[model samples]
Target chain A: MRVPEPPREMYEELEHTADWALRVQGRDLPALFVNAALGMMELAGVRTGDEPGEVRRIELQALDKESLLVDWLHELLVALELEQLAFREIELQITGGKKLVGTFQAVPIISMDKPVKAVTYNELLIQESPDGLEATVVFDV
Target chain B: MTQIRKQDFTRLTPYLWEIPTSFQAGMRVPVRLYADERLLKAALGDKSLQQAINASMLPGLVSHVIVMPDVHQGYGFPIGGVAATRLPSGVVSPGAIGYDINCGVRLLSSEVGLEEAKPFLSDLATALYRNCPSGVGVGGNLRLSAKDLDRVCREGSQWALKNGFANEDDIARTEESGRIPGADPSAVSPRAKQRGRPQLGTLGAGNHFVEVDVVDEIFDEQAAAAMGLTVGQLAVQIHCGSRGFGHQICSDYVREFQPAVKRYKIQLPDRELVCAPLDSPEGKRYMAAMACAANYAFANRQIMAHHVRRSFEETLGGRVADWDLTQVYDIAHNMGKIEEHRVEGELVKVCVHRKGATRAFGPGYEGLPEEYRSLGQPVLVPGSMGTASWVLLGTEGSMEQSFGSTCHGAGRVMSRKRAKKTVRGDRLKAELESRGIHIRARSMPGLAEEAPLAYKDVDAVVEVVARAGIAKKVARLRPVAVIKG
Candidate 1:
């Protein structure tokens, strides 16, 4: 599998902190949300290991895609703590009108470095894009 | 990329503007902004306007929602936003008070000047950092059992005083005498209690700090004198709140409010602004929980002040009494109170939700201590680290215009992520040191997020607040050293 680099032009360099964020552009809502989530986890160097032992499922529905993305991530975090499972990757399928169904594969919890505290709404952006819909988000963790 | 168009404003006066209720659906009142041309323009470039507009949609809001000059975008409401809603008829929103309930600033004045304390600057910073618990998830030295935690929640700063954490003078100087009435420990969740159990006196990370500053200038001589502030004197400012306790409480309630808003048939422009009627079960629970958190914060700061005094005594080789280290004032920024404010000619009890805004009640208000009756409440505005903080006195104008509210601080201009990308923490630290500002922090990344450049100019923010007549500047304080969690 090949990992792709996010486009450089999509992100502006933040002046005083230590992370990078990408302003994602997409034609569809689901793609944009997934890209934003990927960008967030990428900044923190989040990755899943190959040792899979358990299957965890999380579902969320919100009024809009922007909020749906937030709810999705929040659900994932809660699952990580409650189920004591560490997942390497997620497969998300959005069925319009604020509903998203996803399947997550997980392994036994291992010692992890750098925990995310909570997500904040500061500097959150969602806008119309030439391709579809676009958004940028900054998480507090 | 598409460029976002700016909204038009209707000027109500020299310092006020109207964001008409018609601007958005479900808005109960118009949004009022308290800022001049420059500040307003800067605010337009940010998301403060959108947040304020969203907050105006809160249920049962009266007259107009207000934002101070230092307004900036925040969760649920703009950081400097204020809204008053009729109690029982109106609703209480946790987002209005913010996650860090009663997050506030406490100023301590000392007779010693910067020149006298220059030689011991490092020692003082080290002492304070050592004595004060800081960093993410760190516990303080004083551990509390369930019984004691309940007492702290119920009594607030009064509990601290009873436990030898403060004195009578400190109590008199504190806002609300360090305890807000109506706090019921039983109303608070067990999770929140568990979080608060070992965290009293701890400084949680991200914008929380203890700074040593010099009184650089006095804008109003008589007011400054009355506040015991003089040019060149040294002072300490501690900025923190209820930590995980408050955060968990807000999280719990924001989730709980979702269904409450729906059940009440309420409409909102933003879901984050979801609320419940003040008289409803959920609303009463939130207020009680909020009071618990507010009291926890008051106790937290009182304990920190005690530690600060002890550190000073230990470092100077004697009691700090001769140093004249006394409590100046403590004021909450993120809170919602049932206050009596005149609305359209009637003195009605309204729930004033001030998120990232300060209550600057004028003189003669019944809440203030007798000693400060003539002087009004002391409004402490802490600037970003390496910038000039200020002490201002509330004025009658505040009551007339803003429900007795004022700007909180030098609001953030740039996002923390943006700031971190532009400047490395190490380089920023070195730059500040070059300019003679010593900074001690638990993490370099944390320090980077709080770089002074990330915020609006404190001088300009203070000037606008003073010129607007809501608050009168008494003293300007320049930082000598900062210890951040």
Candidate 2:
């Protein structure tokens, strides 16, 4: 299932040597972060259970755009593993491309196809293209 | 960044190949590869060689970078690669060490004959699957609070010993006595500790397993005897790492070291290869935190071994005359160690970073335990599922060439997606069962990704290293049962 993203935002899987990679694009940083979260959830194969859990808020601020992206996904992984929550409804706002505050409607995880160990900074770059912000995220397995 | 071909390499021997320093700019050393004909082509099939060249650019590198037969593409540095940097001046890159800190393997030998235990194989696999907590989001058997978790960092396998899960011999036979020195929990991030605390003894998902193997062949009688390997006897292998604890540690350091590269003025071809001077504060802290994860891994395996022992007793204790399992050796494949090696005929200390490579310190090295000192360290090379695992002995040649390191396992040749597309997991399980292998997996798709055909032949990988004299073969193991998360 495709993760819901802002209009005009897109993400696709990229072939990597040993790990999973995704090429994501958005009209802005907020759109990009939203799609990237969806891409990560897709890569991890998150399955939601029948019972809905609760609404959780994840507020994080990174030094830069790349850090912010990593922090966002890493937080989601922790929530899924530690709290057993899988968020399907996500609202994201990137404040001046630095601060990020997100609210997610989460449910219990029924299953995961595989573990994405952690998101890595290996050749991670958030670049501005003609279309908008584009980046490639690599996940260690 | 260009694709490397076999003709690009200079053949130093039938099994040894080298790429001169002129091939890349800012290289402090050349790249030397150990692989045979077919294996050489396999190494060229991906970015493994270019990654090795990228590794050669690290500052203060002593000798040429070493590439093993099982080389494959990996983030930053290639798997089955080794590089040693000069002490105090060299750089430490967490990327080269990998996300799974001290991801290693431990072998346990049992006296239970395979013939006597054949009927109970299915039960044994089930018992192992039930007892050892595995799969995604599965917590460990024991949950440690913040304080107890700190002790897990500083003490390592000793914590398992104190908890009555490990024995004296198990500790003595482990690498670094199952605890790396200089582990400072204060250096580890609070987030890393929180992720690690509840997951201390878990065998997390993806490529991790507990396999029951039967000794199928013995190549070297003396070495096999020392390891207590008797053909037709049951043996257990635990392959895993530090779990999220190590992942968080590596992630934090890799992110933190991003700016350290500019401060040290060390030019890197890849951003993932960010590093700092060995004596720098950033580097020291990374090493300290890495040590804690390494210790946690040692303990993780210790506890898992304890569970393996329990499973053996529960399944075979009554039927078999003796169902006890003894420790052969436990060694970390992904690790960075400070050791003295001869560079240009002069002995000096260097930090050896082995990524997807096993430490094969030769006989007479002071680091080896007493019984193994004369016979050389046992280099455990587990094969792909249902294939033959190997036991090899380190040689003096390894010390001279590969910095006392060798291949880790049957490196991946096909991507997980491709593997999943090509084979059905349920069908694969049935096929393995037909061949006398019992399988218990939390997820069937995870099994398909690790299908035997998706990896390079383990026998061929071992042959290249043995022919190159980095290590010698001792015995071979065939899988009879496997438990995967």
Candidate 3:
């Protein structure tokens, strides 16, 4: 599995009174999606304390890139709870037009800072920035 | 949207203000607020007023959109907002109800006095933290199959009753008797059920907690006695909603309604405000799915309350004469309910969407449990952790002016990130401990993020609503211990 490297300052947390919002940017759609996943896992407080590792693959398709990002992050949230998995390495690749196959080097979580309840469509907009693409994702925590 | 200045509002009263429809073109109705000048300034500090303006544009809105004193910035709509859409052809926006469907607060009163339990307060906190499952990535005791989970979606607190996690009184005291009727399990998606199944009875993270409090003051003695709340007596407040179950259901519908908005030729300033006509097939399906989530939340809180009672029994039962914990009332702050409200002195059937607000139905509302019918519906407003929570009663003014809705909590003033940066969780815990409040939290950072300083003063928020006559003060509760996820 090919582990992915994210661009510097790909994502940052935005100030929200009631929930967490992430501002993410990347060179392309795939990078944008991966960076958003990493940013979300970061907000979930995914820790690295020499935790046990598991390699897993996820494949999904959506109506478009925005939905794709929401779907990807949502899948991570469910896995974090149901499977007790946190990402250690992130890998994603576009396939067959709308579909994307991704790999996650996950860990048995020692602990996370907080729980991200749901990734919301509230003000979710994937835009064409000068760099490439950027978006803001809000969460129900 | 134009910037809303306090000057733009015409003061209707000491605690009421309004921005007339002429303030904004295309506004179907005016936007009203229950706030004093100070609280109005706090609301104008954020984008809440602009969001309220957006809500006023919604078609079929009855009268105006009511903003509570605790109003703050939220996604598509302001948090502390209540809007009623006329029946038949009016719209229902899931964004207006929030992601955690039926997210609410429940108050459980006990005969045990805080003075008697003071010695065991530490043990009680530990016991509660251990017994009631909470925090990130935590799972509950019960694990259900796909079929049983569907039943949970359908049955709500009744499912808990059948599983020995709840009592008849527990169901009866809850909103909608712990189930939103017409919950069609088929309306819920498989993925939503899967996320919901394991989280049942578990207090999922972020702004959710089980707090042990003392009824510090009673305003309406008769109402307090009816609700079994006495000054100095201990009460447990469970603040959470339908965990992953509700979130998934809302997420599924919000995504589905994106297309529905386009098909209906709706013009929304924000994509998140996607909605459907009340009579459309999508709307019926969403209502059914939302009902399932609402029911699940009722059951979720009921089971947690049950476990909390067990914990109280284990830690304080032998020492106290009575170990029984009775349900005062269980109310949902985030919900969409079909109710009758008078608009312009004419009664109309409407669907009221309360995002981060409580249903403060006046006395004589048929839906309230028989005991509370005379006292009005009990509104439990949990302040931020380490602050004062409230028990208030609905009023005729609420039914007449605000569609029987009041503020939910001490609305957040600072962002979670800012709270973490400004205050250390451990230091905040120490501060609360110095104030004699025992705390058992999963993460210090998590605890810091919910600092009491992050929210508006609960007393002030309560005063505004009380003075406005939307809600009458019943009792004030001061926390003695807190357990957080």
Candidate 4:
């Protein structure tokens, strides 16, 4: 599958580094969240390999979608750190009320580097859309 | 997202709103938010209001919980939240102080100007990045054993000065004079100790930075003179905290307090706001441990300041005295203290928790150094990289309005992932450089997350604090070079 390139206006590239950002934009909430996660992995350069390991099941319920998204990413990063797995593909099923259940395919972390700190609410957004949802998230990498 | 009903705000004045006790059961007093219309609207989009309301429900709160203009959602309490609870009756909540206790900024002024430092800016930044320990879990040059760590936790900057890590001027200018009384190292958890052992003098990642700034403007000439700040003078600002040590201590206490809150029959609107009575064993233990972390942070900044001074001396080739580098002030944004404040026309001792906020004591406050006694405490608000940072002074109004507190920094307007998603670190660096601001960091992604666009306008935030009369503007320092950990 061809990886979608982020919108040009969204990210400003840095000097002497492999990292990139999307400063994502979408009309719907779910789409924004999905794109934000995609953008983070893109910065981590997690797109190339496809090992397709065991399926990892995760479920989280937060007070709101914003909190839910933060918790979801935090759990995912923690799992990646502790389980030594990179999730290549994720199947997210959101139950309108702050709960999300997902099944993800793990990619072995052969040479993973860099730890992400806590997720911040800085410039985070979850907007309503006719099609679905859109959001923006900032991760302290 | 959960649909939380916005609470009807009762305007106490043009700048204050009260979250009445009737709004939620178990609230000992109302919660007061200090912000203008714009800030309030922006806050409506976040969970900070809910957090402040939750904090009001904590046990033994003396009066209304207060939120500053720079408020943003944070764990347990709003980042700019302040709550002062009547001691013995009120309880202490570790969450109110935040994970990074005493996470703060320290400003150092130099006799050198931009012209003198312009030639060496890049080398100076490089030297700072090389000498200072930064990034996640990065160890510092000086490793301390358990005994040494105890001295750091208990004595704070005093320990640093004794070991030649700081100078006399640094101590005199530092808040609490580099030591917070009542810090009992024994109260610190073993895990906290282990984490702090090798982290001294290190700048942890995420919003932590060391910037070379030029005093672009001085708002109050008298205050600026007292601070030794002049237009075009060079200064260094170090932004960091107690690191893992404070995080672990907060974690340990938050967990400990959860059970204590239940045992004490303390009703809280949010689980994260768990707290125990201030006089209780649980609360005392938490405060003691919190002080230990606060002291640790003070020492951390002092050592880092020493390293900065050394870097400047090495790169600029000037004698230490000739450098004329001296600490202006150091203030914490996260921590709780037992302080005296007037409540309902009477003097009362209350436990004040300022998370992502700074204490802005006005003139005549006993806590300020003698030199600044007539001027008030200095409040440092650092903007995002490549932006202007400000120095404000405490006012008498702050004592009555915010329990002697003010804003901390330009509150986040974007999440890190969103900022990174929107901006590439390299491009951001280039953009800043093109605009004449030098950028240096360990990770480009880190740089992207801290892009200036990710934060609220520091100018606007400072204006609110100034207009609200909690703090008065002192000086505006613009970054010439920024180094992020």
The predicted structure with the larger lDDT, 2 or 4, is 2
**What's the lDDT for candidate 4?**
0.77
CA shift of B283, model 1, Å: 0.6
DockQ-based ranking, best first? 3, 2, 1, 4
Candidate 2 yields a Cα-based lDDT of 0.89
Instruction: Give RMSD to native, each candidate.
Output: 4.8, 2.1, 1.9, 7.3
Candidate 1's residue-wise lDDT over B1-485, tens digit each?
A: 11223355688777777877666666678888877778788787766778788788787888899888788767557889999989877999987888789999999988876776777778888998899988754679987999999999899999999999999989888888989888888888787787788789888767889998899998878777766788888888999898877876876787678778889998776666778999999999999989999999999999999988887777755523256579989999999999998888998899999988899999887877776788788999999988899899899988988889999999888876777677788898888878878788877766777888888887888787787889988889998889987
lDDT of 2 at B364: 97
Lowest lDDT sum, 10 consecutive residues, model 3 chain B, at B266-275
In terms of docking quality, how is candidate 2 classified?
medium
> Which residue segments of model 3 deviate by more than 4 Å?
A1-4, A49-55, A94-101
Question: How do the residues A27-139 of candidate 2 rate in per-residue lDDT, one tens digit apiece?
Answer: 78877877887887777788886665687777887767887888888888777778777776787878876798878778888788887788877667899988888999888
Docking class of 1: incorrect
Regarding TM-score, does 2 or 4 come out ahead? 2
Q: lDDT of each model, Cα atoms only?
A: 0.77, 0.89, 0.88, 0.77
* Per-residue lDDT of candidate 3, residues B334-360 (tens digit): 999988888887989999999999999
Docking class of 4: incorrect
For all candidates, what are the clash counts? 15, 0, 1, 42
